[model samples]
Structures are given as structure tokens and as C-alpha cells.
Target: MRKVLITGAAGFLGSHLCDRFIKEGFHVIGMDNLITGDIKNIEHLFKLKQFEFYNHDVTKFVHVPGKLDYILHFASPASPIDYLKIPIQTLKVGSLGTHNLLGLAKEKGSRILIASTSEVYGDPLVHPQSEEYYGNVNTIGPRGVYDEAKRFQESITMAYHTYHGLDTRIARIFNTYGPRMRLNDGRVVPAFIGQALRGENLTIFGNGLQTRSFCYIDDQVEGIYKLLFSDYVYPVNIGNPDEITIKEFAEEVVRLTGTDQKVIYKPLPTDDPLQRQPDISKAKEILGWEPKIGRSEGMKLTLDYFKAFSKEELRKSEHRDFV
Candidate 1:
């Protein structure tokens, strides 16, 4: 069987990728530092002989026992709350961690895929961002930590592809929501769901006018998987183009959850993107991939997953001190 090493293997996206790879009959090596990752997301895979787990930080040297067919670097702290709390670590992982992984991929002659984000298009000046658009990013802003980290990740991956002739792929992921998402991760999906479940008003920042296109987890994974196997070397946007205003999304959540809570407004955080919608032309043209799940269908599945959490778990995740 082909072997793959997935960093951040315990994360929401990484764990799902592990499941997908395992289903494809690959020997999977899962690695994570457990800093922001919950081991429960992947504990179910422990029984499989094809799956192995490593509790190690990728910012240091990354080593595998034998040949690796592929490597997916998904180890960085992805959410706003976690990255804001640990900004330096976020930068290091995107820079140092990515460098380490690229070196390992070279040594093993393995194809590597880097998880870039839509945040690289900081408060994008272009509508429905495409692959060729250069983003307007704030290097000194609060959100810059995550944005710059991802931007650097893409740059280095491309460099490795060109310089070392290393096989590499970059997926510029957009707002994705589904099961295994941390309820208190300071992302809109979980925050709104957690509030509605607790009967609290859904909080919206910046007048709820900011728009975001959310892709379901399954669709996002499928896009990434296709991109990994495709021959595209440049960055590809993997997200649903179905855009919705924050206000509209919150209302949708209310209706979906059958909640009576009202919407509350708060000051929009600094450097928060006012609009986010990916132009997935390349994804469709090249990978022949587009989101198969609609919001209503996807949201219901996500709600069902969150609904399974105990009341105490919901209460604990309902509030997080982002500062």
C-alpha cells in the first residue's frame, strides 16, 4: 500500500483527510502536537492497523520511518482564537514547519500539498477572488498573523516546486463548516451554532454586512483530494461560491436550529475581511470539482453533529476568552 504522512492529523480537516486516505487503502501516519487539536477527533482510527499516530510538533525536524508517497501539511493553528493566542507559533509553523515538511518530501520523493487559506486575500479588493488576484494584506494587523503565515506557505511551496522540482500542490481553502469543528474556535459557523443552541443572540460583527462563502467539509475534502491527485502546480481555490451575508447566515442558522434568539451586533475585529468568495474556475476547469452540498443540506448535517454534544460541552464551548 502507498504510505502518506499527514500533519495536524488530529485537526478537523486533517482528521477527515486521514479518514479519506485510509478509505483509499493507504498506510497513514498521523502526526500532531495536540496543542489545539483534540485527540478525540481521530481516536476512532486507533484500532486500524493501517493507521499510526505521532505526538510530535512539526515546527521541529519531521522524520518518517520509510518511503512516503504523499505528505499533507495541515498542522498550523487555523482558527482566529487559537492563532490570536499563539501568533508566533502560527508564524513558525507556516514558515519553519512548512520548510521542514518540504525537505522531508524531497528526501522521500513524495508529493506534498500545503493548506493555504482565503485569509491570504485580506479584505480582498477584488470581488469573488480568483487565483491570479494579488491580495491586499495588512502585515501588521491582528489577522495578519494567520494571513501572512498562509501567504508565506503558498510562496514557499511554489518555490520548492520550481527550484527543487518537487511535486507540490496548494489548496487555498475558504470558509468550510461541518462536523468535528471546534464549537469555540471563533469561527462564524461554530460561534453561531453554539449561541443558537444556548438560546443566546447570534453575534455579528461589522453590521453583519460582510459576506462569506462557506463550503461543506465533505465538499472541501473532495476538492482537496482531487487537487492532490491532479497535475495542477499553482494554487487553486477550493470553496463554495455560494455567498451569503453574515446577517443572512445568522438568520439561516436561527431557522435551521429552530431558535428564537435575535441577532446582536458587535464591533468588527481589526483586519477582518469584508468580503470572501472564491472563484473556483480553475478548480472546475482542472480538477472537475465543485461543491456538491448546498447550505441547507450541509447545515442540517452540521447541526446534527453539534446537537450530539452534551449540554455541558455546549456550555463550555459557548464562551471563550479570545483575548
Candidate 2:
């Protein structure tokens, strides 16, 4: 059995990756600091004989014994609320955390995949962002903490691949949604769902005309898996290409929840991207991967997840309101 190390193992995407790898019969080593990630996401995996959990922060040195075949560095503060709340940690995890993981991969002679984001295409100048597009980003803006960190992470990761001839893959993920997402993470989908379920007004920043493409979690994980095992070293865009305006998305959520609540518009946050979509031609050509879930179906699945969270769970953590 191949041994794989996954950082941010307790996170939404990390936990899902763990489940996928374990189901494939890989011996999985899960690592996280529990800073923003909750243990509840991967608690069930602890019972598996092939799964091991490490409560270690990846920004520090990683010391896993034995030969490792693969490493998936998914450790970073992904959500806006998360990065804004812990900006330094976000930067450190993306910078130092990626460095530490690359070093481990070098020592273990393992292939590594780093999770890059569409945020690198910050407030993009292009409509449907392709990997070749040099993004229009404000490095000194409020959201720069996360955007620049990811930019740096990708740079250093590629440098290692070039300088040391280390095998590496970069997946520039777009907006992904499904179960296990924090309700109060300030992402539009979960926030709207939580508000609708609680009979509260759904908040929409700006005119709500800004567009975003939502990829289901399963599709996102599948793309990552393909990129990890494939020999593609260039960055691959992994996300759904179906674009929808925020207003349309809000209406869909209201309709799905059967809620009478209305959307309340708020002033747009600083540096919020006005338009975002991914061009997945590279993923399709290189990895033969494309998102399989439709928006309506994915939203319904996410709403059902939010509905499953108990009222008591919501009361404990404001973030739990969405599930």
C-alpha cells in the first residue's frame, strides 16, 4: 500500500481527500493544527485502521518516518473570514508550510501536489481565467494576505521543482462547495444557506451582480486526485465552468430552502472580486477531468448538509450555523 501524507487533514477538503485515499486502500497520514480546522470533520476517520492523525502544524518541520509515496499540501486559511481573522497564520502556512512539505517530499522521494487557488487571479482582468492570464491583484490590499501568500506558495513550489528536479503538481482550484464547509466562513453559499435556514436575511455584498463558478466538492477532489497522480507539472485549473451571478445564486438558495426571507444588500467588501470563473480546458486536455455536478444539484446537497446540523451545534460555534 502507498503511504500518503495530507496536511490540513481535518479541514473540509482535506477530510474528503482522506476518505477518498483511504477508500482506495492507501495508508493515509493526516496532519493539522486545529487552528481553523475542526476535528469533527475527520473524527470518524480515526476509527479506520489505515488512517493516522497528527495534530502538528505544517509551518513547523514535518517529521514523518519511512518512505512516503505522495504528499498533498492543502494546509492554508482558505475562507475570507479565516484568512482575515488569522492573516499571519495564513501567510505562514502558505509560505513556510509549503516549504516544509516540499522538503519532506524531497527527503522521502515522493511526488507532491500543492493546492493553489483562483485567488491568484485576484479581481481578474480576464473574464474566464485561464492559467496563462497574469492576474490583476493588489498586493497591498486588505485581501492581499491570502492572495499574495498563495502567489508566493506557487512560486516557491515551482522553484523547487525546477531547481531540485522535484516532482510537483499545482492545482489552481476555484469556488468549491458541499458538506463540511463552515457555515460562518463568509462564503456566499454557506452564508446564504445558514441565514435562510435560520429565517434571517441573506446578506449580499455590492450589487450582487458579481459572478462566481461553483464546483461541487466531489468534483474538486477528483480533479485534485487526478493531478496528484498524473505527470503534469504545469498548473491545472480545477473547477466548474458554469458561472452564475451572486443574485441568481441567492435566489436559488431561497427557492431551495423554501424560505420567505429576502436578500439584504450590503456595501461591497474591499478587494472583493467582481467577476471570477475558471477555464478548465487545461484540466480536460491534460487530466481528462471536468466537474460532473450541476449548480442546482450541488446547492441542494449543500443545503441538506446545513439542515442536518442540530440547533445545539449551531449554538456552540457561530461557525456551525451553516454546517
lDDT string, candidate 2, 1-323, tens digits: 89999999998899999999998999999999998788999999888889999999999999999989999999998998888889999999999999999999999999999999999999998989999998988998878999999999999999999999999999999999999998888787888887887778878889989999999999999999999988899899999999999999889888899988988887888889999899999999999999999988888888888889898765543553221
Whole-model Cα lDDT of every candidate shown, in order: 0.94, 0.90
| Global lDDT of model 2 | 0.90
Error of 1 at 115 (Å): 0.3
Instruction: Give the alpha carbon lDDT tens digit for every residue of 52-88 in model 1.
Output: 9999999999889888999999999999899999999
Q: What is the Cα-based lDDT of residue 27 in candidate 1?
A: 98
lDDT of 2 at 126: 92
TM-score of 2: 0.97
**Per-model RMSD to reference:** 1.1, 1.8
Q: State the TM-score for model 1.
A: 0.99
